[model samples]
Target: MTTRELTTDVLIVGAGLGGVAAALAAADRGAQVILTEEYEWIGGQLTSQAVPPDEHPWVEEFGITARYRALRDGIRDVYRRRYPLIDDARRIDALNPGAGWVSKLCSEPRIAVGVLEEMLAPHRSTGRIRFLARRRPVAATAEGDRVTSVTLSSEIGEDDVTVRAGYVLDATETGELLPLAGIEYVTGFESRAETGEPSAPEVAQPANIQALSICFAVEHVDGGHTIAKPADYDFWREYMPSAWQGERMLSWTAPNPRTLELSTREFGPNPGDDALAVDADQSRNAGDSNLWIFRRIAARDLFESGFYQSDICLVNWPSIDYFLAPVLDEPRDVELEHYAAARQLSQSMLYWMQTEAPRPDGGTGFPGLRLRPDIMGSDDGLAQAPYHRESRRIRALTTITENDVSYEIRGDAGATRYDDSVGVGMYRIDLHPSTGGDTYIDVASTPFEIPLGALIPQRVTNLLAANKNIGTTHITNGCYRLHPVEWNIGEAAGHLAALCVAEGTTPHEVHADAARLAAYQAELDATGVERHWPEGRVYAY
Candidate 1:
């Protein structure tokens, strides 16, 4: 295999939401940008991982950048222009395309891919941006404290591509570039002594991180389409974790996020229920009463009587959360085993539904449950990759701890305001089950700002964290790892890179000099990046 060399003003090492936003921002300023993704799709969690946006209640009004809002609007436009929608459904001002009860916009993965491609079409045509799919970063070269270049390999073949850029962004899902670049970082949960988070344990658990899920989509059929029982069905069916309040692992009973009390959920389409009536605000309704509409991608009600054959829904519930082992910081073979097990667990959840799930009429076995492989572009009917909740974080100039945003710490005072704020986000500190044998650790948090210090590496001058891998501790990452926040962070990093290049300076100097920092902020304001939330508007569901 031959190695090809490429050069760009900025190179983004993960074409997820963050990478896409970063590339667009830099390329919009006339910077040559090269963005690569490990999967065929550009939107990471929104597309490849099969998880919809986990947004706050006010997403429809504000709390996201303009580019991000455009993506949302574009998804709705796809349905409006392409699909045969009812007049009432099409007339709503803030249309929820999928209306899956998980988020305001819960459309299919393919829809997101289309909208994102359209968003970046201008840059692609102008030759300012290049997007390479199915590419993964393998190695990096550094000079002093700056990353000079990175080597990427084809996931499907042996060809290697090397990219040399003026600035590099680590937007990979697991922060894979951190160790390869020899950058200082941290993973898993920090100790209470380190972060001063009330929920933190006494000792640090490097291997203890949130569980990742391999979600799948399915639709109901008239006849039986039950898949062959998964190989590990028996193992998962019989499994019961010690921390699970004595409920069967495969059952609907799981720990409630707001309160650790065990709660039971009901399954099935629950036909006749209005999709719009399903309030998704967890602070108000949790939205888990019925399984069918929870993440339904194809709601039959929105279309004409025969426009859609069956209602399609995505299965990303707690039953399939894989906490067996940490995927990163482990041997290659061990990691593969865990991934295989996670897939099996997801399949087993489907099998359980088809064979033993309880029904409203006290019946079992919905043999008509058919897996939808077309939705995910995978042969196995599962997502292209697992939904990642955490990433290797840089030990940044300023690390955001739980105390910064926790309502318990700040009360009505709200989140601690940062002088160098770059963007704003709001969400509860919602952590799922972990590989450390711990249950959910959910806490209330106020709206917070994405500090510029968090994006700048403490030692690395040219590398910037563009995703969940910012300077956020485990407790704080719970709130900072949402969709809008990650996009804001990447957009800020992209603009910072462009400004530094134009001024012949570094990010460190831009943050230090008041005049330079104000100029950068002005640039961000002109681009529609909201640096703060509305004054005194408490984030209520």
Candidate 2:
């Protein structure tokens, strides 16, 4: 036990994708930033959670922010420069290293970490950004309507650091600072009567959130890689989810998110499909029917022959979705227990795939399936953290609801156009099975805008919602919680915080005043932030 005190212009209390983006944005604006992360890796879903980017159909084109596009390009560049790519694969400008069907830019999480680190290197060298790894937010000190400082406890040591900043950003995966700062926030499902969302439940269920999955990377090779049976393997092996349509939870048969039909996914490792021919467009094809390539992280065929023995696939399917309990708003012990249980579920799924999964050639299992712990940066083969889909959202100046983006609600009219729009994003309202024992609530949604009002909390003056913690109802979080959208939100929040510090004004003031909001938006436009989607180009899928 030692204590340290530090001060910075901007304090981002989670070095996830959003926090990293926020730190970069703030530092670019000449503000000193202190970014912290609970995990050793910086990128949240991209690295620590080992989930590939779940992007929209037009991701390679104009929908995302300039920085996000740069990050994508950086990932591609790394693969081209570092990896031993085949001549044909190296020639392609948009190179997907993994060729995973879930996203057009599916690649290894380690590559993403490299790109993110490179992006932050200039700022770090200038001493504008200070990144603290293995630090988790423990407490917050708020004076009236503003958070002055946050206390962070080191995960590895007994040392603690209290960071005081001009502006505090809540970018943690679960909105950890929201409760610590006593900010007005909402969790889980909102009642239909409250949000007026067609997909909302009749009564608000704060405990009913999306399932969190513990992802892992694996490659099928000629070896016996079967892990010891997880302690809870027997329970999970025979466990039947209520929404699974009589199929075991550990089996390949699971309900499709959209159709809710029992669909058995085909798993064939190292299928040797043309790596360059992967067209990952969810609108054109939901490519999860093939389990092996659904979230493939490394396609061996794309590299020089014999460079890799097997194509590595990241397992993050519906079969491993842990919906029994939520990690948010629970006691520490309870959260730890559920996280352990989720890991057991994932391990059991892997064990089943190696030990008893029925093969296409009438075999019992694929004994070659090997867990790649090095790929995931974990000793146990599982991801460093769980893939959390939902977060505690702040009650803000404006709340995005299903009525704003749902295709069924808007029809040909398209999503609601916000006057205070700061960024644009597009994704379907895809919700996983919840702890409330409810199945998926998939809905087609039009391309949407991230409003400046959503980033401004109703009462908090200096604290901003940087990631999935923005002012979104439970129904709208399904769309806004994706990778690109979270990045956009964080970039906007960070820039706004810096702007407020420079202009000596608050977020509410800039959002409420038309002239001020316009000026702020002009800056965003100049910096390559798309405030609105193209007219008459709204594609709902």
Candidate 3:
């Protein structure tokens, strides 16, 4: 237990998008900030998880914060500056990548991470920001009521660091720090009787939550240069289900709101770097071969040209998820075991693609499906972390429940009338497959406000939640779990911490002080964070 000590105005645990946003926001407001992450990578879902961001279509014009919008634009700038756009793509453009709901502008995950680092450069140079990568919080020191310091430990090093700050933000993937800090946190799910959430399990079982995905990239190389098979290829080959396509091999599935069942399609493309014209209608019209392929590979041709090979494939079919029931309660070597399982998941998806996917001529498995390790890099051609849709939510002053904000119950939205709005989030109600049951739970959502109370924990005087783990119910979590919304929560938390340090006021006081809270809302608004939806189509989500 070798321990060292340090001090800062604010300390943040976890360097995911939310934590990163918090660090940047607080530091920019002249607060010294120290942030820690378990992984070497910074961007959580956007980078490490290989999740081509789950951004709303209108984000470029009006969805999230100015900071978030800047980050989004930065990703595009990277592509424009580094890659090449084809003549047609460049010429007739309203070029949104993936032709899907998620990322409007898609690029390699690394690009997003690089841009995030650049955004924090000025603050780092000024000593306002310090990144303690590969470290986890060991303990949280509190005095009377306020958090005084936090001890962080790194597995590789002998020395541990203690961070003292006015405010502490918990952005750990699983609310890892909340427990260490003695914060009141909730795990798994609450029973339907408890929260009255239709989606909540009939019985309360917190551990049975959504499973994580370990995604990878691929390329359809011409000729016979298919990549070598993954190490645990057999386990993946045997993974098949009645609900999936082609023996549960490479398949495309999206949550259909009308049917509540996943509509899956078999996807395969020949000669990796090919281009298909996709329109706003979500229609692909590159003629026969494209209609034949219609697969959502990283069609590099969709990007601005000069990007060397507009030909990398992204493997995110629903086939490879590390299902929850099987490994949710693995008591032995959980992290390592999960990693092993996750890798097997990615390899399994690839195996399914390579050796089991359904081809156009009704063939099973396109052995030509190659894993481009160099593209996604070292963490076994997959992301360094798993795609986490839900996590340990804190028991806060106000637990945002489905009754307060679910599309199924609201018909519109439950939390549409938030007066203490710090930010707003709007997305289709999208509950991913959970161990409780396989339910998409997709429904229309009214643009809703995020109450500041949801971000503040009930017990921790100085600690706050800055990720999807914010005080949302299991049901409401579906709408608030996307990338931009998490960034909004984090940015607001950062600004809140800065305000607390400056005014010597606790989050509770600020909430109580309508005058001061209004001022804070003003600041957030001036920073281009929408506390309320505008008076038009924007409001009509």
Candidate 4:
């Protein structure tokens, strides 16, 4: 066995949105950064997990990081330059490539990769940033409360690499570095008594983490070929839960997040409607009734007639959400089992759709739905990573609780304002079915601030949290775990690390000293990070 070693000013152990943002932020500040990812892709949720940006309505005008907006514009530019879009579609100011109702910018994961790669190209070539894909962190070297380095092994049989850095950011999906570094963290739901969240369970449910889905992409075809039956097809075919209102997990009958009532979603080839006509404001309407174009990544109608033959759609619906077991904090074998079962659940879903799904004409199945592994950069058709909704969050200097952002708690008063806000984000408290057999716990939430204190771990002097693993409680995590928010969090973490490195201080010192905190906030402001919302508040996105 051979060992490799590398050193950098900052180390980010995840190539997700946060990791990418963090790397860029640190590199921009002249700090050498090393970013690693378990998958071949760089963008986590945006590229690897295949989930589109779940953003606020005002995203186009304001209330997001400049880099994030750049990413959005880059994706739109990709469509304009590469795809032969309709004149009207191409000219629209806020042209949604896929025009999927789920997001204002529903695009293919591959396009995101291209844009991200271009963003990091300069830094990569100049040696300001070194990105290694298919590297998984296996261990961490901790000196007392600080993480000195991380030991990672190649996922593709390369030599083990040990990376030493002044600052280590846990940007990995699910906060994989927390436990490895012996960082104090919390998992699953914190009891209402602990977090004072209105919707929290009476008792702590360690195994009650939100479900993760193996998102995949598919395109409609005219052929009748269907995917091979999944090994666990029978298990999922008849699967029923006491908390669910549906007969089976595969049907259109699923519990509504807001009302918890049985609801049915219609699936079809295309609505034959204008993409501009589809209003994507989930606050006004969930916009989930139409499944085919809900999160469609490639809309053939928007392009020239012969340009595209099929409308590619990402399958990340409720039917395939796997919550039978919690993947984190479990035995290694158990975690593997949960992941395997989750993939099978998605496969079973496709099989069910192909063989037995009820069509509008009362047809049995639509075997023409062809899986597109190329879209997701996966040979097995599954997403590079599961769509994780929750993570092991650090016990930070400031923990965002349900009371801070909950509309039920704050009402017309709006979410609590933070003086040390580093960025801003908006989304509903949308918790999917969990391992504890709980149904969706979606609730309205006001636009919230991302406090810099949330990124600073309480005990770890040098380690920082840059992803969904920040100091957000289970209930609050629902709203904070979106694409833009995670990016903002990572960006903030990166800037914070750069500041600390430049000042010869720790994250704790920055938070503790009023002067340093103000300076840090000023840096964030200068970096085009939106730290607050507009005066007039209107929640629709």
Candidate 5:
């Protein structure tokens, strides 16, 4: 019954990469910004989700927009400032100058939180920008084609704050706002007839999307004692995923045989050692050391000191991704149950490592697998939130299908010519399978642009979705659902909202006028936001 109201030019929901990008872009454009996050901290995947950067090998060279590229650079800057390596004795700046495979900022969630806070410091100082943390949208007021105001509930205190903004951007992981705002959305897969996505199943149903992950930290005990058994050990031990029928958890003792076969098929190197050795020749990472072992391995130096006081490596590998979907078919508390099952699987993997995993000459693993909760900024002994891989997509002006972007589907894909293009994203269509009985739906893709029409609602003029909620089919959603691309989408929405406010033009109008839309694209590009891939050579990693 308690409610208060505030006003802003732009309201950004979810403080993940997309939301952060929107915040930065809007604030930079001199818009009154109100950024809200359900979690206490910001930096969606990089900070709170505890997942390492799944960067393309050409990250440094090209393919991503300037803002996303800046984020990658910012991560590198953090590591360069933090570490004082022995390599500095020879080369001053060579003190852990990142890798070509991924950027240098390989630390815990807190590091990115700190980085995001620093990035927003200037905006926070200006007083025009405000961040409402631990808050989520409950309802939205729509008048004609515009959203008048949105009501949000704060977990910090039991109060509802109605934020009246010119525009509302939904950057949530599950696209939570689409349903709350009564926006029409599509869930689950689309049939081949619907999207003609070669990998698309025959019938599209509300089955599992991708499995949610409860990423945990771990450190080798060396000669220490054994780790404890997980509470739900029974359920995970009996797990046989639909997409994969291998053992519930692959580890030092057990490897996914299909992975080896896939590696051989691709002509990649074989580096499936029982333990990852920090050898001097660390440059030889082109092999499958990253592929086989890393999903479950967390580095010793990946977190801040005293954060966990243990060398906490996170467990989010291929083995423990629970194949249940939380947004669809609850099946009697699926989120809670699936999370528990995932934790048990990871913990059991740790246990097996200590009790039965192979040693140098085929002995058991070292005990004392330690975990770090400080990295995630919660005492729950797990990630702050589930590593959500997919979400409900809105039915917008243009629905990008697999044929439009997927490399497997579209050979030598060209950036679709759109007069309404507002943003750009380029990552492989990487869909980690779920309980729906699928495989790793990983498809290579070319750089693609986002159309402004895709963000506009047919019925709602005042409302625009910025996150995975936009009109992308499930097949194309695989590429659009990543950390950086989400940022570009949300940032474009923020720009569109500000334009709507200043020029009094709706998103549809902006797209309708070629001259005005061209001006908008020019403005975005002037501000370092690339709407399409510039001339660059594409390389295979």
Candidate 6:
């Protein structure tokens, strides 16, 4: 109804992990920042999306930025200080509160929200960083080659806010600001001829985006906590994906991402496995063999005896992946419909588990499975947002293709080294089933570099790709879209924006000039941003 105007040195739209990292980095560098989020919580994948970090093998020791390490440490310290952990867990340096196999540090999403807020507390207190929650970007004003302002409408029916900034960062999931700003961006799959990526399809399928999953938390306990059957239960239960080899979508049996084999995963709630023995090394073990321990967030054995009646396991399994439709670049009503369908799919999966899912001991159903809404910070028990694996990528000066990172393509040469490298990340090319009826396109990849050119759009003068929206092809997006990589991308974008503001320069200018680029990278080095991997320490896949 009403309009409000605000100005900042840096405006980050989307308070996800990347957006939060960007805000902190910009604010720490003495830039006035305005960070906004559509959700009530800030952390994207960690909080709103409710997906644990899928990190590299060396995550505990290296290959991450200093700020990211601090966030991880903060998560662990939260459990050590507040939660009732056992003596061994309390003493261990890297105590996984969730003890989830997906990541080294998997805990409650709300915990990540607290840690992220605390990380931005000092900046917020000093008025350097202003966080606007429950605000979604609706419009943008671009002047020739620059985004002058972005208009955000309030979700809670407050006044519409227009943010004018020296530099704008598109950190939203699905790259929400790209189209609004009239930026040149690509969505869905690129053609094999277009990208020369082996994994790319023969023809470009713009509507064939990766499957989005609506995650939820559940714990097994006494008594029946069976939820009402979802309306689409019959449709989902009877559905068998072609790639799944006749396995029902709601069942525990599904095709493995890497192998594509019909792997039957085991599920048993409160199976008192030694939580301390969980070695979450994905490179060595995919860890999805057991649906229960695969993403167990809170192992009861990790805490004091009887502190937890059952292990809190997050349901982000393959069974719940919603590939029926693409959520991005659709009409508002259509997008909402897809999201509702995704929710139904997740709920249907839960209902199936509670009613008809096959047990390890030849029984059927685990009626004791209870949804934990408090853990996810949602009333309906589902996550605040869907886990989006891909985003609208900006057409940049340097687009990272599968040829650059694929281990099979590069061989002993390692990944393509970047002269304008801003950071480093590593993950396999892990594309899930798409709306185009495509199966998983998983491929081993080498540790890769994030070039400054990837962050800078080809035509946009003041806007930066701060999340999975960088100059990465659909094939390469799989590896670059992980938690640490996204954080690094955002951090680099924020720091670059701050540096540009301080230096009275544009991103293109800094990137084109070798000296300026080197100086900017030096600042990143000083801040503990790993610009390059070790000379000999290269790991494939």
Count of backbone collisions in candidate 3: 14
- Whole-model Cα lDDT per candidate? 0.87, 0.91, 0.71, 0.90, 0.66, 0.92
TM-score per candidate: 0.98, 0.99, 0.89, 0.98, 0.86, 0.99
**Candidate 6 positional error at 31, Å:** 0.6
Better of 1 and 2 by TM-score: 2
In model 5, the clashing pairs are 18-487, 145-461, 145-462, 146-462, 147-462, 218-313, 295-317, 298-313
Q: What is the per-residue lDDT of model 2 for residues 1-541, given as tens digits with 9 covering 90 to 100?
A: 8789999889998888888888888888878899999998999989999999989888877899899999999999888888899999899877888889999888888889989999999999989999888999988998999898999999999599999999999999999999999999999999999999878889999989999999999998897988998899999998999999788988889998898988888989999798899999989999999999989989999998899899999999998999997789898889999999999999999999999999999988888999888888899989999999999999999999999998888898888999999999989999999999999989999999999889989998999999999999888999999999999999999998888888889888899899999998998898889999877675757
User: lDDT tens string, model 3, 279-304?
Assistant: 32211221112322332435655655
* lDDT (Cα) of model 4: 0.90
Worst 10-residue stretch by lDDT in candidate 2?
532-541
Ranking by lDDT: 6, 2, 4, 1, 3, 5
Query: TM-score of the candidate numbered 3?
Result: 0.89
What tens-digit string does per-residue lDDT give for candidate 4 at 417-513? 9888999999999999898888899888998999888998999999999999999999899999999999999999998898788889999998888
**What does candidate 1's lDDT look like per residue over 1-541, in tens digits?**
9999999889999988888889889888778899999987888988999888889888888889998999988898889999998888888767775667878788889999988899899999988899877899889999999999999999989589999999999999889999999999999999998888899999999899999999998888688888999999999998887557777789878877777788888777536567555456666777876778888888777877777677888998889999988987776689779989999999999999899988777898778788989999899999998898989999998899989999989888889898899999989998989999988888889889999999999999988999999999988999999888889999999888877777778888888889988989988999999998898676664
Span of 10 residues, lowest total lDDT, candidate 6: 532-541
Candidate 4's C-alpha runs over 4 A off are: none
State, as a TM-score between 0 and 1, how close model 6 is to the true structure.
0.99
Backbone atom clashes (below 3 Å) for every candidate: 0, 0, 14, 1, 8, 1
lDDT of 2: 0.91
Give each prediction's root-mean-square deviation over alpha carbons: 1.2, 0.9, 3.7, 1.1, 4.7, 0.9
Question: What stretches of model 2 exceed 4 Å from their correct place?
Answer: 538-540
RMSD of 4: 1.1
| lDDT, candidate 6, at 345 | 96
